[model samples]
Structures are given as C-alpha cells and as structure tokens.
Target: MSATFVDVEDVRQRLGSFGVWIAPMTLLTTPVATQRAQFARIESLGYGSLWSGEPPADSPMGGREAFAEHGVMLAATERIVVGTGVANITRRDPAAMHSGAATLAEAYPGRFILGIGGQTGDSPLSQLRAYLDGMDAAATQVLSETAYPRLLAALGPKTHDVAAQRTHGVHPFMQPVEHTANARRLLGPEPLLIPHQFLMLNEDAETARGAIRSVFGSDAGLPNGFYANNFRRLGFTDDDLLDGLSDRFIDAVLAWGGRDDIVSRSRAHLHAGADHVLLHPIAHDLTAAVDQLELLAPLLHN
Candidate 1:
C-alpha cells in the first residue's frame, strides 16, 4: 500500500507507554475459558495492548492461525488493544490477511492492529514492498470501512522509510534502545515507533542467557539470521553473537534483574524516542508470564 492514511496520534495514544508482546505458546494449548480469563486479567491490570508473535503453521514454534488467537484476545477484553506483533506475509495471501484484519476491525474497531512482515529473498526489502502492494490491492475489496492501523516489521533505514510512508509506522522486535533512537531520528516524530523488548526475570546471568539462547537458537552455528544481522549493525561483534549470545549483547537487548532495572530499560526506550514499548517476558509458562507483567505493572505507569 502507498501510505494509506491512519490516525497516527490515536494509535500512539491507545498503545500507551508500555504493553505486553508474547507468542503465548502455552496459552494456545489451554482451554478457551482459561485463555479468556487470563487475557481479561491482563486487560484489567491496565495493559494498553497485547501483541502475539505468529510462527508459520507446522513450524516448531507451533501455530497455524494468528487470526483465531487474535479473535479470542479481542473477545476477551473490553478495552485493551489486541494485535499481531508481526504476522508473516508468507503464511497467507494478502486478501486473506486484509479480510481477516478487517473482520476484526469491524468487530472491535480501533482495538485491532494488523502488523505484517517476514519476507525473504535476494532482495527482502523489494519483496516486502511488493507484498505491501498486494495488501493495498486487497484493501479495495474489503467490504467494511472500519478503521485500524497497519505497521511493518522494519530494521534497515530504507525499510524504515517504507514503513513510515506505507503504514502507520514500524513495530521493531528484539532491538535495543539505540535502534529506537536511530529509528526516531529517521522517522522524524509523528510516526508510530513501538519497539519490542525481550525480558527475563532471572538474577543469574548464566541461566537467564541460556534460556534466551535456547529460544533464539544458533549458539555456535547456523546462518546469520535477520535478528543477528540487526545486532551486528548495532555494533555487536560476531564473538558477542557466537558465544551463545555474549553478556554484552544480551545485556543490551534483555530487560532482566530488578523490576526497577527493567522499568528503567523501558523508560530508556521512551527517552530515546519510542512512542511505546512492548515487553515480552520469556517465561516457562503462562502463569509466570502473567506474574512478570503484574510485577512490572505498577512501575510502568504511563
């Protein structure tokens, strides 16, 4: 799409200063009632939004339908916003993505955001831009005009510009405050800039970093993926990335240790120019995730 207009200020206001972003692998396995209650509790706790990561169907990450989970999240909450952190475009046709998002938007109105990305090719940037074109064409056929914002998962400067022009703004994942600052500088001021911060509550560095590595993989080997390359651009050395993720890089990206410390890290994103920040707690299960959010709730006052 070629920058269809959206109320950027409204989106910024609804997102608030801090919110939760999680894949909810464990919760997806639970009963409908249980999932509904927990999501409602998070809304009751005053979270501005809930964002879920969508792994492609049949992948080890475990999920086929991002839209179904989004529907449940929206239905359970009376106020809090629900969104895909970034629904991979490769997983579904543009028409399907647009209609599904429009359906939710028609139901919940401003409470739904459709964030999309995950393109791979010799020219990933060109691929994503083309994907947006497809989505734009699909928007012509969407029946209802119920409004919602769209955000791109961008890292490089060019993609960031594309995001600013083509969508509301960007939803950057697994990046540090420095990246947020750079993005803000590139985007000027009005565009929505929500950076996803990874969090672990452990006090022990070894154990905490181990958990992150297991989830992220590619400790000693494997191709340098999108995230690792972004880290490199941020000045993280190969050594920092290769040694099961060095303490230096981990310390930059993860909000761990004291509750105050985590809050401080999130605030740094705000100071660096993030309109909002989504904190994803990498916990053992759903209960631990909720506990972590509850623990941070008081400190994250908007």
Candidate 2:
C-alpha cells in the first residue's frame, strides 16, 4: 500500500514542538466568540496546533463535534493548526466525515488535519480499511490534490501499518514516551508520529494523579479495552493495572510537577522520535486548562 497523502513534512513543521489537546470550546455552551478568543490566546502564546476530538456529549471529557469545533478554532486563529485528534468513525459515515474534513482543509488550506479513529468493528483493521475505502470513494479532486494530512489514532503495529500505508501516521493517546519510541521503530522514521501526553500542573502527586484517574482510569483493565491492552503491550504489569493504577503506571502516563518536570517530559517524547506531542492538561474546565498551558508556555514552547 502506498500513501495518497504526501505533505507529511509540511504538517510536521506546522505542529512545532507542542500542541494542545482539549475540548473546552464544545464541551460547554461557551459562546463562539469566547471559543475563538481562547484559541487565539493559545496561538498567541506560541503553541503550534490545537487538537480536539469528537467525543460523545455524555462522555466524561464532555462532548464536542470535531469538525464544527475545528472550524471555529481555525476561524479564530491565523497561524496555529487545528486538528481532529480524531473524529469517531463509528459516529459518522465515511461520506459525511470526508465532506466535513474536505470543507475544513479547503477553507483552512494547510492549517487543518483530518485525524480520524474510534472504530467499533469486530475486525479492526478490516473495518478501518473499509472505512477508508468509503472515505476515498467520496473524495473530491480538490481534496485528493490538496494532500491535506490525515492520521489514524493507532497505538500498535497493525494499525500503524494501516496509517503508514494510507494516511500520514498515528496519534497514540494515553501512552508513555516508550510508546513513542516503539511507534517510531514501527514506522521506520518517515511517517508522522504525534503522541498525546497527559499533563497536570499540580505539585502533589496524589492530587495530580487523581485528576488523571477521574478521566482515564475507569476504562482500564477491561478484557476488551484498547488502552488496557496497549498498557500490557508497553510492559506495564497486572499489578500496575489493579487498584486505581500503580504509582509507576500513573507516573508513566501523566506528567505532573513543576515547569521543568513537564518540559522534560515533553522533550522525552520528542527525543523518543515523536514529530509532535499534543499536551493534554488535566483540568476540570476550559479556563483552568488554558491557564495551565499559559503557565507552562515559558518552558514548553519551541
């Protein structure tokens, strides 16, 4: 399989060293102006891209439609790239996803990326293959020639192969820097690798960890869970899996401490071969998330 999308390097440059991942805009009934304002502020702070996803409204992270939010964010900022860290494939048909993504890419030009995932198929790869087929069939000439970047929210080799062959690369969330190293080895140094890092500005380990747990811990340890399976693949123990996650597990997955600690953590992923690391600040609301990023900007921005 060969890649139809070929503008990977340009996308990498636009992503810079760190981009933010949050759903504060669509998570609430926040005014569009406010959404634009917050996005503008982050761009002004010198962050490269701002990533978000299409989570269900009732989801613990709060729901926001990916494309709609991407549009608003794109309209709000002039330089910062906006991406759907993933728009759930299970939630929309291929044609709809293609149309929405193309519209954004055309409007935003090189500033938008159509990162997609969240498949519920029995045969995950086969299911995603079909999904891409539908999306491709629906593609327009402008979109095909635009070469707007795309990615799969993949964590393992199989899906990484799919991403390498089809889209630009993979966006692995909830994994550590080691996962970035392993993904780089799997991708063999060309395909784009953007891993999401959970960050908290809290000083106390327990408080910071508790915030991450409230967001991702409940879904761990499931026999059929993707994140739990990814954890095992990364060599975390069953002991690390049980009892609200071992301290080691929490430490590996979440970056918490002073400015230097968080900055070093992001650098670790970049050193591990990630082209860009999407920083997910563990905050209860948009205001807090934005404030945290501002505090880290002095050390984090490239």
Model 2's lDDT to the true fold?
A: 0.82
Off by over 4 Å in 2: 1-5, 24-26, 56-62, 140-144, 216-223
Superposing all C-alpha atoms, what RMSD in Å does each candidate have to the true structure?
1.9, 2.4
- Candidates' TM-scores? 0.94, 0.92
**Highest TM-score against the true fold, candidate:** 1
After superposition on all CA atoms, how large is the RMSD of candidate 1?
1.9
Total clashes in model 2, counting residue pairs 3 or more apart in sequence or in different chains? 0
Quote the positional error of residue 146 for candidate 2 in Å: 3.5
lDDT (tens digit, per residue) of candidate 1 on 74-146: 9999988888878888789887888888889889978998888887769988888777787778777674365
Backbone Cα, N, C clashes tallied per candidate: 1, 0
Q: In candidate 1, which residue pairs clash?
A: 1-132
TM-score of 1: 0.94
